[model samples]
Target chain A: MAEIVLNALAHTYSRKPNAPQDYAIRQMNQVWEQGGAYALLGPSGCGKSTLLNIISGLLEPSDGEILFDGVKVNSLPPEERNIAQVFQFPVIYDTMTVFDNLAFPLRNMKTPAHLIQSKVHEIADILELSPLLHKKAKNLTADEKQKVSMGRGLVRDNVSAILFDEPLTVIDPQLKWKLRRKLKQIHDQFNITMIYVTHDQLEAATFADKIAVMYEGQIVQFGSPHELFENPKHTFVGYFIGSPGMNFMNVQLEEQHFVFEDMKLKVPEKILDKIQHLPYESIKLGIRPEFVHVWDKKNDEAYEVDVIDSEDLGTYHIMTFKLRNQLLKARLHEDQRIPKHKAWISFPDQWLKVYVNEYLVEADDE
Target chain B: MNKIENNKAWFLVLPVFVLVAFSAIIPLMTVVNYSVQDVFDTNTRYFVGTEWFKAILNDAALQSALMKQFMFSFTTLSIEIPLGIGIALLMPKRGMAASLCLVLIALPLLIPLNVVGTIWQIFTRSDIGLMGWSLREMGVAYNISRNPVDAWATIILMDVWHWTPLIALLCYSGLRSIPEAYYQAARIDRASRWAIFRYIQLPKLTNVLIIGILLRFMDSFMIYAEPFVLTGGGPGSSTTFLSQALTTMAIGQFDVGPAAAFSIIYFLIILAVSWVFYTTIMNMQKEK
Candidate 1:
């Protein structure tokens, strides 16, 4: 296994990318440490697959260098790179038995027959496919076919990394969890660098130690799941990573105070002191719906808002509110009372994050 | 769930049944009637009771024609299947060049069968044809009308030129239907080029290859028009095929009893061979 490093890697489908939209993958520089489980998380068409393809050497980057273990391998083809990839759809040789499908890579390398058998048996046992060894690959279920695809990767002797591009999209929901657990078990046993790409946050959080959030062909934030939920580096990350997402409102900074329409919000003294040194005019305040505390009585630092709608989601109620012309959502517990027309909500100081130009801004920053 | 049982839906199928009967079954019954009788004329006929069938089976001319017919079908299929696959492999995968190559390859398939024969007849003529005149100028004696080898070669070449495109087109569509991910996965698996072809491309092309082979076999077995126009079964009976012999007996000589028996035998051979091809290929796929 090797530590994969992307040094200023960028790719564009067009020969000449005159604008940012023309680029499928904007410039990126990141390192995937050896034996680390990482997730490249994004919505559809946000260049996650393009990035995965580039990393696997399926698509050469337009401008950059890829280094495996600090060796420049930018011009190397996928076969020479020793990188295995599982695709979104299950890909298996339909005419081959499941045993032969798992033995394919080893057989291609001209490995001895006995060695190939052992490797095949090992992977099949791990994937719970031992009983299907002699069956034709085409007759298997969708998830079993996917298991064979992954088994092809695991059967190899020297794969530097295994890249997965939403490998669970075709699997039944109940089977997806079992397959994901198998993947984790494989990662623990093999100790190879694994990069999983997906749009589902739960899948990413459950699989990878670190999640790289991509938006508009750029990785806006890379951190653990806890960090992504608590202190998002970009507004997109905050909005993308949560169930209800972080609620953000456009605010203006006036004489060391934050103003949103007619509601005035109090800022901490340290944040207020740092506000004078802000570099941008556009400002926003963000807080997770789970952190928005609602009260029926007027309390200190509370603002009144009209309740537009409320939905009881069994475990929690998602209450929608309107302040001036902006809509806000708050999540309440099952035992919590639902206020009538008007409700007072409080944004805790620690939970409130300030954004300057759609990027997170720290109070301690210069 | 309760099942709905209704007999009225059969009325919708009656139209197709009537069409099949009028087009196929009725004509076949007439042939059966003729095969079992000695028809001297419409008014004068006698029951032959398989006499014509036994005589036609023992006829030396019909036996040789049947041999020639099998040889021709086998020769053309052996040449065209490999040649068409090669052309498909060399063809471009995408963009304007792929479209241009497709159109060029499909040009000969659009030509009428009789027109193709006439074109080749002129093309192989010694007097005014480009290929024939050039071969003579190069000191090669090539005359389809006189020499059996030259006649056989020319007919095979003509059949190849006229029908190789059908196999190529079927194979091209089959190749296009394979998703791009298979190739990528093969590359990542470090499979050799030949390995990719053997496991991926060849397996995926199995269905189309079956269709191509069976179509070529059945068509070439019943081949007429082209060879009839080109050689007129010339020099000797060397190039006379089963269809030409059947045509001479039925239409030229008006031997309706023997011709009807020969037609039934021809239909049975085609049906048996096609069924064999289909079942063998399908079983091979399942076994793998």
Candidate 2:
């Protein structure tokens, strides 16, 4: 395994690609450590796959230097990079037996016959595909075909890394969990550097050691799942990471107090001072749905809210309300009783975040 | 609501069956009748009991034509299949270039069979055609109208030019049907260009290639119009294929009994060969 470094990486497909806006991927500087399981996670058209392709040597960055183990590899082809990939759909030689499909790369590399059989058997056993060894790949079911595709990547031990691009999208929902867990097991056993690309947050959270959340052709945040969930640096991160994502309500800061509609709430003095000098006309208070506590009546710590609707989701209730005419969601315990017409909630100052123009503003200690 | 049952669907196929019966079944029965009889015109017919079959079985002319047909089919298949695939591989996958390539390839297929023959007839003449004049200027002694070797080369080249694009277009559609993710996976596997073609592209192309081979075989075996027009079975009958021989017996000699017998045998040969090709390809595909 080798540490891969991307230095000032940017790509543009046009002939005259000098302008900053012409680039699909802007200048990105990052290091993917050896033997780490990383994921490039983003919505469609977000350039996550582009970044993965560039790293695999399938695409050359218009301006950048990529180094593998401190050796320049930007000019290398995929064959020279020594990496394996599993696609969203299984790509197997349909005319060959399942065994042949797995053994093809080894055969191309001129591995000895005995070693090829042993390696094929080893991977087949791990993937639980021993029963399909003699069958033609085209005759297999979709999941079986996908297992063959995965085995082709896993059977080789000499590769530097394995890249997966939404490899489970075609899998049945019931089988996705099993395959994902199996992949994690394989990674743990092999300790190979793996980079997976997907738009599914749950898949990225469950699979990768480090998740790089991308948006609009840029890496919005690169951190552990916990870090991304707890302390999102950008507004898009807050809006994207959760199921019922974080809520952002506009507020006005005056001294150590913040005003929302007719209500004034006290904030920490330092946070108030940090925002006082900003030119923005409004500040945003961001909080996750689970962190907001709903109350039955007005209290010193609570803000008045007009309840709109409540949806019971078996394990929890998703309560929707209007604060200063802006929609907000609050997750409450399943058994908790909430009043229909009116409700009050407390935005715990400790969990509350302040933002100015999508960038997080410093919070002051009161 | 209950699902609608359409038992009357058979009515929709009745006309097709009648048309096929009139066009295929009646002629087949007539050929079978002639195969077993001796006829001296519409006035007299006699039961001959497979005498013509025995004669055809031993005839040297029949044997030579059969060998020629086999060579033609095999050569055409070998040249067309790979050339088509190579051209298709080089074609742009999408956009204006794809449409342009498609139109250019399809142009030859849309030309009438007789027109293709007439066009090549003039195109290969030593005095007027660009190809013939260029060959002469390059110091090559070439004349399709007089030389057997030139005749064979010209016919083969014409067939290749007319039909290779069909196979290529079919293979092109097959290649396009593949998801981009597969290519990505191949790249990730660090598969060499040869490995990618052998393992991924070729296997994916099997179904279309089968169609291409069968179609090309059937078309090449029945070839008559172009060679008949260009060579006119000349240079001592070097290019007189099975179809031309059958037509000579039926139309030129008016030997109905022998011609009918030959037609039946010719039809069966094509059917049997096509069956073998289909079965072998399908079986190979199944093994994978």
Candidate 3:
């Protein structure tokens, strides 16, 4: 186990990346401390898998230095790097028994039969696959096959890190939870540095200590789940993380205040000062759907909007309101009163996030 | 919950049934009829009651031919399977090169068996042929007509040259069907090249290999044309296989009853061996 550092890592499928879009993974530097669990989180085709493959040495970065324990391993093969990767679909040797499948890596290193047996038994017991030891890997169900793949990774003691590229994509929803918990338990037990790649925010939040949010082939933000929720470093993160996500409204700094359409949104003085200095022409105001307080009366600091649609989502309600052709969503709790066609809404100053050119501008916390 | 009996569907199957009966059953019955009786003429025949089968089984020339047939089939399979896999592995996977290699490798298979034998016959002539002249230039005695060993070697090589491409093409398709994820996983597992072959490539090729083996075994066991054209059962019947023996008995010698029995035996052997290969390979897959 070793700390993994990617220094200005970039990958381009094309020999000559003429434009920024040509790069599958744009230039970025990141680090994973030894034994840290990180989720490379993004939507599909956002380069999470590309980054994961680069880290596992499955795909060498077109440019960059990958250092393990401060030693350059950029040119190392996956085998030499001692990295294990579990793919989106379960990959198992179809002709081998589950025991042999689990014993594969150890046997590859020519480990003695007795040692392999013990290791196989241990991993099988941990994965609850002891009963399936004699069964062919091809005969197992999807999750069981996935467990076998994981067992192959876990069988080897010298593996520096285990990279998972959306390993749960094919598993059923019921089994996804159990398998994810099993993976978490295995991480705690093995203390191997694990990087889990996924597009599901819930899976990322539940499985990883830190979630690296990727957008457009770049890691826009890296932080703990709580930090990502409270203060997303990029507007994409704010829009991607939560249920219904954070609602963003296009705004312009005019004269002294921020104007969204004809409504002048009230912002904290410190934020207003930062907004004045923002060099971008386009500005946006972001707030989580939960933070937009809906009111029955047209109170001070409240802006009037027409309710377009309201969905009753069991425990809470998500009400979509239109303010001068701009749609805004406010999540209301079960006890909160449902508004009529016309409703007055206000985004609390504490939850107000200012964005310049889609990147978060530091907001003053209440 | 009553089930409907579809008696009308039988009418729909009548056309195919009649076609199969005319094309297959009638000829097969004629062969059976010939096998069971000794016919002096169409009107006068004696019911032999397995006498022809017994006589043909005891025939030493037919026995030797059967042995030769088995030897040829087994030897060709053993050589071709691994050689085909190797060639397939070396074949380019995609793009223009792959297409070119496929066309080139398949060229030999497309030629008629007789033409292939004739081409090799002229090509192996020491006086005028490239391969034979090259061997002669190298001072090695390589004559197909003069020595049994040389004839057998040449026949086997000709068969390899003609049919190994079929196996290789099947294996190429099999290898192409395998997803890239398996290789990636193997690499991550630190699998040796041999281990990758043994575990990933070999197991994935099982289905296609079974088809290749079955087709090759049946086709080789019924070998007639190529050897007939090239060797002509030459150098003391060294290459006279089952089909040639059956041909001699039925056509050359005019022993209808015995030839019909031998034909049944040959058909049974091919059927039995094909069944065995199919069941054994399929069972191996299911068991594992």
**Against the true two-chain complex, what DockQ does each candidate achieve?**
0.74, 0.56, 0.77
lDDT of 1 by residue, A196-292 (tens): 9999999999999999999988999999999999999899998999989999999988885798887777777777776667788678899999999
Cα distance off (Å), candidate 2, residue B128: 3.8
**Candidate 1 at B13: error in angstroms?**
6.7
- Pairs in clash, predicted candidate 2: A136-B288, A271-A364
Query: Of models 2 and 3, which has the larger TM-score?
Result: 3
lDDT score, candidate 2, position A143 = 80
- At residue A136, candidate 3 shows an lDDT of 86
- Model 3 Cα lDDT, one tens digit per residue, B146-222: 89999999999999999999999999999999899999999988888998899999999988998899999999999
Give the 10-residue window scoring lowest on summed lDDT in candidate 3 chain A. A263-272
Q: Interface RMSD (Å), each candidate? A: 1.5, 2.2, 1.3
Global lDDT of model 2: 0.85
Candidate 2 ranges with C-alpha deviation above 4 Å: A17-21, A254-256, A364-366, B1-17, B92-100, B129-146
Can you rank all candidates by lDDT, best first?
1, 3, 2
> Docking category for candidate 1?
medium
Q: All candidates' TM-scores?
A: 0.96, 0.91, 0.96
